[model samples]
Structure formats: structure tokens, C-alpha cells
Target: MGARCSKFSLCWWPSHIRSNRHDSSDVDEKDSLPGFIEYSLDQLRAATSGFSPDSIVSEHGEKAPNVVYRGKLEDDRWVAVKRFNKLAWPDSRQFLEEAQAVGQLRHMRLANLIGCCCQGEERLLVAEFMPNETLSKHLFHWENQPMKWAMRLRVALYLAQALEYCSSKGRVLYHDLNAYRILFDQDANPRLSCFGLMKNSRDGKSYSTNLAFTPPEYLRTGRVTAESVVYSFGTLLLDLLSGKHIPPSHALDLIKSKNFLMLMDSCLEGHFSNDDGTDLVRLASRCLQYEPRERPNAKSLVTALAPLQKETGAPSYVLMSIPQVSSSSKQTVPLTPLGEASYRRDLTAIHEILEKVGYKDDEGVANELSFQMWTNQLQETLNSKKQGDAAFRAKDLSTAIDCYTQFIDGGTMISPTVYARRCLCYLMNEMPQEALGDAMQAQSVSPDWPTAFYLQAAALFSLGMDDDARESLTDGASMEAKKHRN
Candidate 1:
């Protein structure tokens, strides 16, 4: 993951901001990150509806360095797919090298990479979907209630930690650490985008769009170092404090004259303590220092913010009194542990009911009876699962589905993830009824699995059961929230 942090983050910022700047876009891809998958272009196209316009997720729309699209895999898992412009990487190997490097990073405060696709002219990077949207939306474009002081402090701390983690891993050049690069997870925690690290392009251009957002040194030297990242971080601090894009120079002027009240966001009135605000102001001032060496390192920034971290049991959404997740399907529901044994019992009950009233296919032996031969059956099932996974990665839906069915038909093991994957494939094939059945089977296997409910919701929606789909979506969302809360 650290390798990914160094690669993708470097590619992220300058790529987005480049206009007349010196291009510096070469990526060193010697490092290997664990658990990163190589996705086929067809799979990405299927996931993102052929890179349709409706899937655009970037703030600047299609005109940016890379376009982002929201997508869902065959497993009902949501992801954000970033596709670089055609000219960004003329060499396919260069693009893959950059992507492979970025795909290695994984951190709680950073969006984790799911996979990458490098086919012909296409260079795509897939990462975990953040449902709560970007920090810019919640701050500047705030529609709901204003963000609370505690939540802001939390966001600051989380961003600092993310930067600290990246810097510690030798990924110190975060090209643009702005509000747009900060996203909120399902739990409403702030996640620093790995996309801020912009790699030097082949054309020698270093930066792009919105020159006002660029650090002074970047404009002068056309290069970024560790200290340059601190400058961007300082600019971000200003954004958080003012709830607007105040120039760093202007912000420094305000800070010098003890005119913090004027610099602070009016919407945050009465929420923060005077001392805390002053402390943050001071820190931001230090970060905005003209001389690169005068700026505090990410580690030092984290240390300074340590005392300001408020200890409260309240989640971010609650503290701000504003919904974090954008989904209308969100629900408030408490959760508790349902042991594995209980889940197995549920699966047995469901199987009995399904056999009695639900659809049934001829398979000679009972699933329950099949489990007695666990030793050989489990191994065979695992092998079939591997084949299914490989087929799924290759975008061979029919073959993948067949493989999964073979695994499930064995019935020696209960894997909700497998059921969910097959369920999604069924949905993709326009077999909503089968998808719904698999979703139910998944729930029976692992009743606490949030994704099973979501798959049920998707299947229901396809079948025109709008109200039921809404209910299922709500249940899934609630379960997801519960998982995060725990």
C-alpha cells in the first residue's frame, strides 16, 4: 500500500492541475504492493457502463487530467474508477508501472485501491467508493447543517495522520492536499486521497488547472519536494478554517495581524473554543511560511494537533447534525453479534423453507447431507472458487457464474461472499429472480452480511419491486453503518 501511496498520489495532483506547466510524468514501478488486482478493460467497462457520462465522479467533470467514474462490480461492491486522459501516458508500460505502484497503497484514512486496468490506450485505477462524498461538498458547498467544530477538528487530525503515514512510507510529495482530495468514508471519517501525488509527465509539464491553488514554489521551480507538500497542507488548513479558497498569501496576512475572527468561517460560529481556533491558526501560519524549511513536517503537524483532538463517543455525522452519506437509503438501526453457529442454523432453516416453497433444481443429493464429506468437498469447492474468481477477473460472467454454481452446489461450505458474487452475475445476466434467490441464500449463510441485503435490493429494483428495494437498501445501509460504528 505504501508503494501505491508513493505512485498514485504523485500522479494525482499535477495531472489534475496541468495547463502550461512543465510536465514531469515518469513513474518508477519497482516496488510491489500486496493484494492489488490486475483488472481487464472489459471488466472495468462492464462495471462502469462502458465509461458512460452518467458515471462521472470528478468535480471538474470530463475536462480534468483524469476522469473518475462511479462503478459497481459483479459482486455488488461499489468502486471509484479513475481513467487518465489519452495523452497522459503515451507508453502503456509507463501507465501500468504508475498504476501498479499506486495500487499498492492501503490505509484507513486513505481510499484503498481495489484494482487497475491497463489495456491499449486505457489507464484506469479503481479504489474503494466513499459514499459521503468529498470534504469540499460538506464544507464550501454545504447543503445541510454546518459542520461542527469537533468534526472539523477530527477531519484535521485524520488528514494529518494520513499525510504522516504517507510521508513515513517515503511518499512525501503530496502535490495538492486540498478539500477536493479529502473524502468521507461510510463511517464519515475523513480520508486523504492518494490521488494528490502527481507524477511528472513525459511532456515535462508539472502542474495543471486552477493555478491559484498551486503552491508558490511549484510555480517557480516547476518541481515538488517534501516541503512543497507541507505548503499544500497549509493551504488545506486555510480552506478548513475559512470554508473558502483563501490564497495562502492572503491567509498569512490575516494571520499576522491577529485577525483570525475575520479569517474563520462564519458558519462555524459558536462551535469552537477560542483557544483551539487560535492554536489551529498558529499552526496554519507556520505551515504557510514562505521559506520551505520553515514549514512544519507532517509528523510535527500531527504532534501539534494531538492536544486538540476531542475525545467524544459521538460519530462525525452526529456531531455536525448533518448526514454524511449521500444515499437516501441510509437508516438508523442498532446491531449485535449473531454467532457463526446461529448463522448456520439460519442457513439450515432457510434451506428447508426454500426447498419446500421456493424454487428448486434437480441436484440428486441434499446440501445438508453433502456437508458430511467436508474434507474433499471443501478442497474442491475452494478450487472451483479460485476458477470462479479468475473468470470473474477476466470478465467472463457466464463462466464465472457456472464456476460459482458448481462451488455452491457442493454445499459443504457457507460463503456469503461467493453467493453475493454469483448473485451479481445473475443480476447482470438479467436473471433478477435468480439474483434474489442467491441474495437470500447469502443472507442465510451470513445473516449479518450487509452486501447480501444490498444485492437483494438491486435484484428487487430490477424486478420493479420499488418499495421492497427501498426497504432492502435501507436495511443494507443500516447494517453497513452498524459495522462501522462497532
Candidate 2:
């Protein structure tokens, strides 16, 4: 007879079997590459406040055709928006295909692509924002102490891993893999920019920097390949070794003359041993080999540098001396009932408050509809609100959302309370972006309503936006106190 199955037996399965299942699921998810989104142009515009000048984060000025802006999504998540010029990608389909391909890549070593936008005569790509800035600023023009030797080694290894992962996924061509393309995340870990994965333009020049830094093969063929990327990586290796950007040709000459000390950065003295220096220099020489086929692959580079890693147990933030707050440092603040629910992100308590308040706050708000239009649609709009209120009280979120959307689209009347109720419904359904939009709409309809700010705070907190949520909560508290005084 077959073995009998029981709950106890299910829980007592072999550890290796469970481990293998988990690993297989991870590989499947990575290969499938799900979760990439296509954002609307209006959404992107609102995120950047109509692409304001102050939001510009790209090193290139705003006049540059391809400019990157830092923006906050409706969900309160910060993102980097790269807007390409109109003529940059005239073929919208091709631009979208390339972005989709890059968006499929998800890795911790990369500033992974989040989404893209392709509207009429407009093309944009959205990526996870890196707040700390680029490798160029920190390495060459550091305001604080120079990047330590361990951090430099970590950057090299992390970059190699990024390239190796990309190559494994059949994305080997990286245009202009330089210090500027490398960025530091909030934790100060190095990440390769996904923007470099896509070509700038169909007929545009491949290399943006000086021709002296270009690979010999690229110069001859007028095209970049996997080997060309390896060549650029070698130049970056040289940059990390030296405090400044030295021409690759001159650096190779120094390497050939056995002047290892000359190639080393003065700031890195007393940090790395002679053996480590010699090993890195030899690796850089192999990467910069004249023959394209003779260069070591990314996997080999990882192997060569694995044993050279320093401070293996130390966190990147600590090694880089970047300030980070610990959980223990956070203090709890006393809050009113509504404030307490928002602070704790209690969706049910918020729903209860919405039901209790009802449309009492919306009283005396004027409607600008003409008599004829009001007579035509007033009953229909009122019916939609009545149904939405019933669904909201019944805790039927989907029905409530549908009814509220109907009432909103009717255009005969405006109700901030209805928007707030729909905002809570969206939150309970795990749609924070839509919830945030509704909350903002509520504030626009009734700017002084403290409940609008409270709902906004709840939605922001749900999106992991602690700082913005706290500010919104404070605003709500102040408004409530002011109303009481009146």
C-alpha cells in the first residue's frame, strides 16, 4: 500500500526537498520576469509635478535631450524618470520593445527598470531612484573622506556580478560603462544603471566620452559588443585604482612597465597590500587586452576577485560611513483616535470613521452645474452616491469602488467625503496609488478638511513613505486643532 498522507507527515518533509522547491521557485520567478508596469503619461507628469525644473537630477543640464528627473509616484514611492527627446526614438514601437526587454531584468546589483511611458511624441523610462548619487562624484570629487579600499573592491565585485547576470540573461551590450553609470543606493551599495542597457539612438555615436577611452574594436567597427563592454569595465577598474580618470592607453603602458605603484591612487596608500594591488592590476590588464577574444569574461573576473574581497562581514553603509537610523532610535508619538488608526495603518478603523462621518462635512459645498444639466443628471448622481454609501457601510470594497467611480464620472456634483470613502476602499484592496490619487482629489475639493490629510497619511504609509506620512499626519492634527478652536 502507498504511504498514508497526514498533516504531521506534510510538516515533517525532508529539509532538502523543501530547499530544492524554494530554489526552483526562485529560478522560475527570475526567468519569468513578471511585475513590470506600463505607466500613463499623465501619471508620470503628476509624479514629477509636470516635470518641474527643480526635479532634474541628471548630471547633464535640462537642455540635454535625454534628461533624468527625480519624481514621487502617487503611491509616494520615489523614482527616477528618464525622458528621451522627441526625435530620440522616432519609432515608438522599437523604443517600447527595448524598454520591455530591459524591464524584464530584475537584480539587486542593478538599478532595475520599474516601468516606461510611450505617449504621443513622448518617450520616457522609469527606474528605482538612487539617492546617494553617482560613482563619479563620490570617487573623483568626494566631499568627505575618499572612498575606502574595501568599498572600492566591493564596487568592482558588485559590478562584475551585474554584468555576469546580464550576460547570463543574453544582455551583454552595455553602452558607456563608466563611473557615471554606476550609482550608490540608499544603503550605499553599488548598482549598474539599467539606462546603459539600451542604446541612445539608432544612428547616434556609440561612445559619449572621449575617443581615447573607447575600445580599439569599437573604434574600428563603429559598433559595441560584449568585448567592448569588458574593455570599458577595465577603464572603470583603472578609475577605481586611481583617484582620477587616466586614459586607458597610458594606464596600460604603466601596467606593461611594471609600475604598479604609479597606477595606484595616493589616497588608497596604506589601505591595500602589495599583493592585492598586483592582483587587481593584472586583472585590469587582462580585461584591457588588445584582442577582443583574449579578454576574460565576467564570470572569470568574478573568480579572480572573489579571494581578494575585503571586510566580508561589514555592511556597505557602515563601510562607506553613510548615516543610517536604527529601529531603536525611533520614538512613538501619542495620537488621537483617527490619527492613531492612520499611524498604525488600521484600514478597518479608518473605514469605521468614514461611515460615522458620512457626508456631513460636505454640507453647503457649492455645485457649479447649470439648471438644465443638474436636472438631467442630479438624480442619477445621487443614486450612485446612495449605492456607494450602502456598499461602504456593508464593507463591500469592490462594489463601493464601482459606485464611487460612477458618481465621480457623473460630473453633476462634487463630494470630498465620497472621494475619501473611495480612497479607503482602494487602500483596503491594496491599491495605494489609486488611493493616494483619491485622497489628493479630496484635498483639492475641500482643502481645509483634516480627514483628507488623514486619509493621505494612511495611503502614504501603506506605500512605505514614512517621512511623507508623518508630515501629512502632522498637517491633519494641526487642521483638527484649528477647527476645534473655531
Candidate 2's clash total is 0
Using all chains and alpha carbons, the TM-scores for the candidates as numbered come to 0.60, 0.62
Q: Give a tens-digit lDDT track for model 2, residues 385-481.
A: 9999899999899999999999999988989999899999999999998898888888888877878878887888899876677667666755664
How does candidate 1 score on lDDT? 0.66
TM-score of 1: 0.60
* Candidate 2 displacement at residue 99 in angstroms: 0.5
Ten-residue region with minimum lDDT total, candidate 1: 1-10
Off by over 4 Å in 1: 1-34, 59-65, 201-208, 320-486
RMSD in angstroms, candidate 1?
A: 17.6
> Each model's number of backbone clashes?
24, 0
lDDT of 2 at 94: 90
